[model samples]
Target: MESGMFEDEFQNDGSFLHDEFEDGENFEDTENETSDATDDPKRQGWLVQIRNLNGEVTERRMWAKQVPKLPVTEQIIVPFKGNQPVGTDIDGLLGQYLGRLASNHKLLPISFKKWPEVVKTYKDWVWEKHIKWEPIHEAAARTSFMMDMGKKWRENRIRLFHTKFDQTLSREENIRNPPLSIPPTEWAAFIDYRLEEDTTKKSKQNAANRAKLTINHTGGSKKLKRRSEEIMSQIGKPVSRGTLYIETHKRRDGSYINEEARQVCEKIAEIESQGTVPVEVAIDDSLGQVKGAEHYGRVRAI
Candidate 1:
């Protein structure tokens, strides 16, 4: 049931990473980044807020050393501070591991509804392999591991479609370079699906929708949520989304990364000057000029 539903989502939305040919700048670029925070969490210190007995509030410094850590293959990670993992991508660290687990377990056509099953399989496999993990830190269930797996599954499928499997090439030629995790049988079916007329049309439509995006992030794979939290820790107050957006899109030289960013930041500044306008409202006003979408303000799901 879930597989069929999610299969429709794929057909209607294509890879959801980007346009058919590349991991579009929309999501694949925003969400796919490697974390280099594997060193001593002490270096990051703890970005924390302290409330005193006098009802006064002050920010403080801390680290992953203060919180629990998850053993994710090679690096130790603190999983989204016990919240829904969004905006950030751990594909660099966990993508291949997820791919292998799903392939080995015959858990192809991954779906959100089946994430619990996948997590169960992961736990069982970890136990069998005797991989040590804190009982509380279940990477499969707690972090964005499953989501990254889903993205990797779709991204690699499209990559294979574009790069290795040539339309002019014979079936044997195309299937010869099947992805490491994909079986030959699955590869042949994938090729057939991509060649189907309905599939081609849907992919084109989805790509068109993605291309309509007016804003592109320059935050580069850094998780803005964590970065915002760090800023709050330093400034001792909440950072508005508008401020964060403008800050992230600017270069060290105080120049906007692109014209669109400059325009959006300008619009935000205008909105702020008028009175108090929500960040999303400011973004909608700016984005609506180019892209006709209404209320499409949430960029970073983090």
Candidate 2:
């Protein structure tokens, strides 16, 4: 009798009772299986998130149709934005171009300390965009892409600044004098005075050395000691070099005071003329005597 009852319960081609015990179990398993299939990363599409300047975050679910197919391996080529292609030698013209952008683009410092961070940030952005770039090609791709982006950004920013703010971009001619009360023209003289002071110290030491050598220690000569005192008295007196410097300063308004120093000043002036001056600002946003950025902008009209 028990065998017959077990056979009836297990029959495959017969009627079955539908209740929570059986139906609920099957339904739960099927729902979980569907959830797992949908959650499978391989089968899922991409999602993109963008945060705007106003701090609003927007998300987009990208479907397959929305994405472009990856090009075949053989079809891949170095991306050329202008005449130059990605991964090409950048040590020449491209480097110079980036350097100019660094100089002219106020937003881009293009400094040794900051460039690596910029590159890394760009790489992360590309990754977020689902651009599957290889590790070997990442640097070239990032550099080329950044160059194109920076060039455009700088140009657009300049245009915007001019159009909206009624201000042109700052140039080398705008370089201000050093914040010291002394004029830049007088710096050459000041530096001369300091340099003469330096030479006098050396002269003092030389005088001491000479006095020691000339002293007749065995005879204990009083005249020789007086001579030593006379030599020491001349220690602070300007040397021939200082006199020559003074003459040159008078000749050309100190333009020829220190040839090397003058050359450096000229080189600095040249760079400033091109608006490539390296400026330092306190984190408090002071630019020399300019109190704040707003005041600085008013002064610079940048």
Candidate 3:
């Protein structure tokens, strides 16, 4: 029966259900009370005032967890010293108050007693280790004076120092006196120098012109013949006399005729001297005469 009773107790889920119910209620209560609970600390009356030995009321705040305990008489003395008031039996009350002030003002929390020694050590170290090497106003002035003196010495040395070759006595003895009023002989020498230059320039120009003539007469002739052959080949037939003349004259070296061309040209010249009308004009004149022979004869010089 006890075993059965234990099994029944294990199966019972009421306690678990009750816990869940309680948790839901507690969550609701927490949600409703959260804002009030959060504001309670800030709204607390932490700041207070107490009378000092001088009968002046001094204000203090009890915000921090660790309150400074001091004797009432000593606390009174602190207010006289312009320190924060504290409760009796507080140790380091003044320091703690000063620490809060320093924290609030973003100042380093330095003990008044140690400040003088720290400053003294800092000044001594700076002077001995670093300041001595630094250029101060007085040192800079002295250095500038030395520099000026060095510059002046260098200038003087440059002006004074001279080798035997540079000595004025040697130079004066060797000086060629400025040509005693530039004699007429010197004018003749100047003319000779200018003549020599002009002769050299003229010779150079003549040599260049000769070289250009040789290139044009020799190399240019071959190039011109090749170009004329190309033009004739492109025309694909014997060119008319007038057309051939124009094309040959346009070439660089075609001004001079080959032997064959010279013979042909002589024959043409002989034919031209015969006083015959050219075929072009003869044909046109024949046609005109047929149309009106009397009018054509009057127009013609014949």
| Total residue pair clashes for candidate 1 | 6
Worst 10 residues of 2 by lDDT: 1-10
Please give the distance, in angstroms, between residue 274's alpha carbon in candidate 3 and its true position after superposition: 99
Give one digit per residue, the lDDT tens place, for model 2 in 1-302: 00000011111211110111112111101011112122355644333332333334344443322222322211112223333232211112222223223333222322212234445554354333423333444455456546654553344333322332211422222123222322444333323332356645964786688786521211111122222223235565312211221222322244443455444334434443453323332322212222224443443211
lDDT of all predictions: 0.45, 0.30, 0.29
Which residues of candidate 2, in runs, are more than 4 Å off?
1-123, 126-132, 166-302
Question: For residues 1-302, could you state the per-residue lDDT of candidate 3 as single tens digits?
Answer: 00000011112210000001111111101011122112255543234333334545455543222222322321211211112122221112222222232222112111212223224454333223211211222244224323332333232222222211133443233233212322334323322332356745964787788876421221221223233334456877533332333344333455543554444444544554454525233433322322234443453211
Clashes of 2: 3
Question: Positional deviation of 120 in candidate 3, in angstroms?
Answer: 6.5
- 178: Cα error in model 2, Å: 34
Return the TM-score for candidate 1, rounded to 2 decimals.
Answer: 0.52
Winner on lDDT (2 vs 3): 2
Write candidate 1's Cα lDDT for 1-302 as tens digits: 00000111111210111001112211212122223332354444333333323334344343322211222212222232343322122222233244443333234432222334445665454333422333433443334555655555565556546766677878778868776645677677677778679878988998999999776666654457756665576779766666676778787688898888798788766655564554343344423433345445455323
TM per model? 0.52, 0.20, 0.13
Model 3 clash pairs are: 69-89, 69-90, 70-88, 70-89, 70-90, 71-89
The lDDT, on a scale of 0 to 1, for candidate 1 is 0.45
Indicate the residue-level lDDT of 167 in model 1.
72
